[model samples]
Target chain A: MNKFGIVMLYSILLFSNQIFGQFNALEKGVFSGSFESISQWYQDDNKIIVSVPQDKWATNNYLSLHYTFGKFYAGLQYEAYMPPLLGYSRKFDGSGVAHKFFSYRGDFMEITVGDFYEQFGSGLIFRAYENRQLGIDNALNGVNIRLKPSDFFSLKLVYGKQRKYFEESNGILRGLDGDLDIIKLFKIQKNIGLQIGASLLSHYELYTGADPLFPPTVNSYSGRLDFNSTRLTLSSEYVFKESDPLDLNYFWYKTGNALLLNAAYASNGLAMNLSLRRLENMDSRSERTATDTELMINFLPANTKQHKYSLANIYPYSAQVMGEIGGQYSVFYKIPTGSLLGGKYGTKLNFNYSVYYGLDTTFLGGTQGFESKYFAYGEELYYQDINFELDKKWSKAFKTVLGYMNQRYNKAQVDGGDYPIVNSDIVFFDFLVKFPKNRSIRTEIQHLSTKDDLKSWVAALIELNINPSWTIYAADMYNYGNAGEKVHYYNVGTSFVKNVHRIEISYSRQRESLMCVGGVCRQVPAFKGLTLNISSSF
Target chain B: MKKVRIILLVVSVLIALGNQSEAQTVLPNVMVESITGQEVSAMNFFNDGKPMIISFWATWCKPCILELDAISDEYDEWREETGVILLAVSIDDERSLASVKTLSAGRDWPFTIYLDKNQDLKRALNVVNVPHTFLLNGKGEIVWQHNSYVPGAEQELYEEILKLTENK
Candidate 1:
């Protein structure tokens, strides 16, 4: 199948060129693509206890090409994972042409055949997407059509099977989404905007199990409304799913539901946002038996703030797919340049608070999963965080950022571990100073203190940036307060970037950690290795 | 047989490259949502026969914020000198999307912002990382692009814009 795909792709390219060559006007086609390679060579480390893979080296490569001519477009992506990286799923052990599609995008309508990624309003009910870092690519292999008949309404239809690694899942999925611009349709107030959207999705698979009451089909629906203006924005979505007896839910036939609400107001130098979400048995997959980010048909992102600092990300939040309730509120403000706190360049301040808890439920054995009251809080706290940051520019060349965070993470609930809830406080200071000839240096010093689980840690990093192309950095993280062995995870790296090409080389001791992108996460195993990354687009 | 297949693939790619015409580097016609919740075509983002900068960034990316902040400090001078317009495209999905408006407004950045909620434009542009920026000429052709951002990188970007305007 892989060979056929490759052959067919090449054939299309060749055939298209020949067919378009007959017309001089159609010869003006655009070809664009990108290539990326991440390779690692591992070495044994005496300070850490980690089981290295037998290969001792691994590389992941991706090459994608896209061609656009007039209103028609086609693209394909080929991926190769030579002895897949440690902690990556074993399913992606080989190489293949993973994605391919052709589509005609007109002003009023679009139609696509083959593979495509799509999402409904906020992706509450259905979303077919990919996150390469998380080893997730659930692009549907089938047909997709989008129609915009008027200025006020648009509709999308999709029917396909979800992609699982290099193969397609057995289940067939069908989805329909429609959106209406209420303000535009009704010619209402010009100062305000309102929109409404709804989605319906269903999955069907053959039943092969022995359970007589098992369902081979599941259906889900979602509705959303959005309001927008120059200063205020509000949106809400609600999803409901029919009974789905899947492995993730312990074969429970109970229905699923979710709700998400967001509101934001922004004005000169001041902005505030609040988001609330509740998820109950909302996990849906094309393959009933699939688990661990595989074959997911919907996306439910964690509402917590995404941290950039290394230490602050140690206990990142992963959304509880089964049942959880959470909300986050954030505020951003800037002091005027002439104010007392603002010096000459003004100061920026940010504050955020987020919390999550498990759902209160009464469990019933067998096909009946559990029952829970609406808007009730559970006794078990999943996660909580409160953080504040201040950024100040003292001079033209000198700037600093100070931040503090307090967090409580329930290890047993988020990650399947038999451990008590861990509470920690983190403080960090970052400084950047510029020099002549476009040379600059940035430094960060951070400390994390806790009484439980890993005790405490201290980390520091310094980076130098050279104009036009070069960046070098070194960092060290020490587990100083650990009761057991004290270890230092150190890293040094340099990168040279020019135009669309970037090459980076690094040597480091990688601590076992969960790397996440946009709320999706994957565990990376500990190893000492020299890493090389090369990427370019043309 | 494997070697033959490899050779065929290489030959086909070379042929495709050879057949490339002098096509203008225009933005993909993908639909993205404006900050005001209106759907707009990315291809229509032009500066009325002036230079434009389209930057792909996320709220969580520290370097992206730093670069934008640095640009904001000099944006007035840049616009006055080169008549260049900046378009900040937020690739934040539903997770950290709400903060985009707040961050931009709070920072008082003088740039038009759009939301690529599903990352259609990001994928089309083949941007693997944030802080990737493209500089387009008056003809809407992508003339210069850079990946990643370091402190003072905006100076180099300004130089590129100067070169574009000088040519004009």
Candidate 2:
């Protein structure tokens, strides 16, 4: 329940493990857990446009403990925030037992109580999860039970109130899902595996608005089918929601719909995947009045390349809940080691392309916001990326990765339009050299030449490891395209690691930008500060 | 009342474990999805009672990929001596699920892999970072675990597997 209690419990666990080893002959269970604590000190710097709100110091900590014995398992998570970080929400400025659950999984059935997270079919219709960096925890706080009567049939039932901030949402949510293995169900000895599933989710809350057509409850249903073989896999899901007036949709009583499809083919040295999604008024939330990353009950993943490079991710994308159509296609190929293009080691070439367009819709004003035609695209382009990369190992001691990208980001459409559309060309290089005695050095260099927005920029990072124990990292990003003085953002840090404990301290100047994780974006203002991070596990 | 229930659950579990002490370190029976989008249980992945080396990783973590590559270089030699299998667990969220599938194919990883999209297994195993590896004996009990990566960490892992078979 508290830090002291947790430490005491762990001590008791360690003490009991010793006693049990001597007395209990048949059973020897294990207790394992980890904790991470971050502390930061902020200092104001008008030169870099960093403004620190009244508070200058912030710290956050989380400790989770899990115990497993035979078929029974229990876990507890404790979190403390002595005033959360700047970008993190203030609502988390407290200490408490964030999650606690007990579950028993048997051959025929599994049951859980307290807090739990789950998802169904690409999470297009329902997803309950926790993203600590984003300050979101929608874990169900009730009961969940799954029944596997046979190898072919599986069913699940869940009821709970969604977690919001430090508390639970007012509305109550309930869902039931059933999955059937068609091939196994019929005992059909076929090559391809077939599975189908259906889910019905509902949310209930008291009506507080005077609108006569406003419904106090919302219902959504989803169905999915999946087929897979040794080299091919296909999965599709469709969802529909009843008419409900909520803030996200201007309190208009409009129905919602969504469709997602993914198909892939893979061989020994080649693989390709394609994804398609269409969402129209499909923003589902627990509370009718919730808006903008609040009380979300479903997850609509943005079908775009999640770039690994810093500059490539500058213009990230989030799926529009109102109306959007998009898809992504990616291919990965490995040239054999002895081929003409492949030198001594095999060469890896990756190509990725993605595009999203706004829905072609006309507004009717008043309660009727707009109307759109299916399978029609507007002239507006939300985001696009054409990227290719090649990875090669020149020798046993050297390896390198080269990449190029062309991107078009519609600021008005993707980032709520504070600036003009930005088109950029990027080049990336990564080299790693390994020396004897487990020593290694890695360097990453990226250059983005943009004609708009922040203009052209260049970044370089180097990481040197003195083998098994110590590492030093440094990086700097400079914006040269900006007229007049060049703006530079730099950071240097060192980390020491031994066994399960790791500690890192760094001082850096951050650039103001929108950082995104899984299509969800958060604004991180420019700041000059010292950060300390520590992690330990047992 | 909530805190009390939590304490009660923990105490009850401790008592149960104390009373039902059993041999054979067992992997927790958690459900995870494979690359083909099929739901599978971790319990059935014991490799017919062979040694198992499980690694948790993410696409964005560069060190993790490096470590896996090093292990892949000698995977065949290790398999010859001990009937061991490698199980790679990708904790990539929905954003990078495509890459996980695509990379698995192009690289032709010679191991069984699963996706822990929501980190259920990662949390169950208390892995704090990517590149964390676990070595399990023939009995499926997790005998050794190490976090992070060094160039020759796999050698240490192999030694543990050798110790397991020797004890047998």
Best by DockQ: 1
Best candidate (score: TM-score): 1
- The interface RMSD for candidate 2 is 5.8
Error in Å for residue A472 of model 1 = 0.8
Model 1 sits at an interface RMSD, in angstroms, of 3.1
Native interface contact recovery, all models: 0.65, 0.44
Task: For model 2, state the Cα shift of residue A383 in Å.
Answer: 0.3
Could you estimate the TM-score for every candidate?
0.96, 0.92
- Encode model 2's per-residue lDDT on A126-154: one tens digit a residue: 88987766677789889989899998899
The DockQ values of the predictions, listed in order, are 0.57, 0.34
Q: Model 2's DockQ? A: 0.34
**Chain B TM, per prediction:** 0.87, 0.83
Model 2 clashing residue pairs (backbone): A26-B21, A26-B22, A27-B21, A27-B22, A28-B22, A412-A417, B25-B141
Docking class of 2: acceptable
